[model samples]
Target: MINAKNLTKRFGKVDALKGLNLHVKKGSIQGLIGPNGAGKSTTIKILSTLVIANSGDVTINDIPLKRGVSVRSMIGVVPETPRLHENKSARSELRFHAKLYGMSQKEAKSRISDLLYAVQLEDAADRPIRGYSTGMKKRVALALALLHEPEILLLDEPMSGLDPVIRKQFKEIILDLKEMGKTILVSDHDLYTVEELCDSVTIIQDGKTVVEDTIESLRHETGSIAIELRVSDDSTMDGLESKLTSLDCVTDVSQKRGWVIVKVRDSKTDIPVVIHTASNHTDILEAKQTKITLEDIFLKFAGGHHG
Candidate 1:
């Protein structure tokens, strides 16, 4: 439902967005993943009509995204950091948002109650936000963003710094919103979470789109499936190399200090060949196959694994 073409945003000598182009289908749960200084938050701000780009074009729902009186009625925004008034109670904070949207006192109260329940914050509704936990405040922020029932949500690192349980809750909430046909554009570096939650992804590096596709398709395009071989000795890689590469699925192989790393075009049938090679052609302690996770793909492209 959103389209950006030749979008470039520069701050002095730094190009935060270097001719970025994005296409997010309507009602799709799409992710924007990249490293630090990858222009993720900048893209969110431009789309939310909160920041003006120097030059570019973007459209939301066939309408050009420009500063307009009614733009607020169609978009919801959750920033990377919670900006709630520390002194305000959670209930009051949501109510304030409802008031800004011109809801009557009774309507605001009813909506606030429903939102508090949706976010599972009813028990702590009366506590000042200053005393709330990180996850608690994020829930309230999400509730406030949804108070107006906007059609699209722009989330900037919505799950950053949350515990695993809280991340699962947020992922479920995002999926629920997707089911309701609310278009979501989220920027996060958490590959595992994004792969679990997003239908498609657009990967950026150094302020440019590198890959954009369904997670599975991107994995395929990476041209390799990870093959983990537990061999009695790493020297087995040499005896198995010819047989392993002879298989159609096996594309490449590498031997480490004692482990064999094979990149396969497909893991379904190729894994067994690897095991057979390790067993008959050579010697092995064990062998198994696993799909290459997004983390693996990122590390491959990043030139070296971080740890």
Candidate 2:
């Protein structure tokens, strides 16, 4: 439902985005992830029409981003740091946003009521936003974003300061939106959350698109698999590492906290060999395969130049 091509943005001499391309399918949640200064926020701002890119083409629902082709009504944005009127109650703030979208008094009130309930802010709807906790404020922001019931949702670090409880709650809300056919593009540093919530992910680094694919596909393409082996004796750890390193499938080996961590080319085919080799060297306390994570992929791409 959203497409951005050849997006390039620059401020002074620093380029924030360099020919970055992102695509989000309808009713799917796409995660945009990168390290600091990797142009994640800049991409969101351009898609939200808050910042005009120096060179790029973006469209929402086949509507090109140009003058007179209104896209704001079709998008809901929840920024990393939401700004709300401190003195205004949650209900009042939502009403204000609804009115800004030209909703009538009756419609605005109905939407405000429903949104407050959806974000679980019904009880505190009348309280001023300044007194709200960080999680509470995030809920208020989410309510405000859905006030217009837009077709597309852009969430930049939506779970930034949320506690575990609220974070789970927020994730449920996103899942519900997806079921309702809302196209969502969410960016966050939490790889686990992204892996859990996103259908596909786009990894960008140094203002460039490094990789974009499903988590499984990315993991397979990267060929990064890990195995954790607990040895009974620390002295035998070096021998175990040496044995595992001799295997052709094994790429690198290291020891941590009395455990030998081995990186392999393919865990499915190489883990058994790793176990057999370790068994001959030391008493195996535990030998388990570790799935490659999104963080591992991010570090592999963003930390260094690797295709």
Q: Which model scores highest in TM-score?
A: 2
What Cα-based lDDT does every candidate model obtain?
Answer: 0.81, 0.88
Task: Give per-residue CA lDDT, model 2, range 1-307, as digits (tens).
Answer: 9999999999999899999999999999999998877889999988988888999899899889976667999999998788999999999898888778999999888878888877888989998999999889989989877888899999999998888987998999999999999999999989999999998999998888888888888787655688999988888988888888888988778888888988888666888888888888889998877877888778777867532
Per-residue lDDT of 1-307 in model 1, one digit per residue for the tens?
Answer: 8888777788899889887788899999899988888888888888888788877888988888765634667889988887999999999998888888999999989889988987889999999999999888888888888899899998888887778887887888899999999999988888888888888888776767777778778788776576866676655567776667777777777666576778888666777766766678666766656677888666656433221
**Any idea what lDDT model 2 has?**
0.88
Q: Which pairs clash (backbone N, Cα, C closer than 3 Å) in model 2?
A: none
Clashes of 1: 4
User: Stretches of candidate 2 above 4 Å error?
Assistant: 265-268, 305-307
**With candidate 2 superimposed using the best TM-score fit, by how many Å does residue 92's alpha carbon deviate from the native?**
0.9
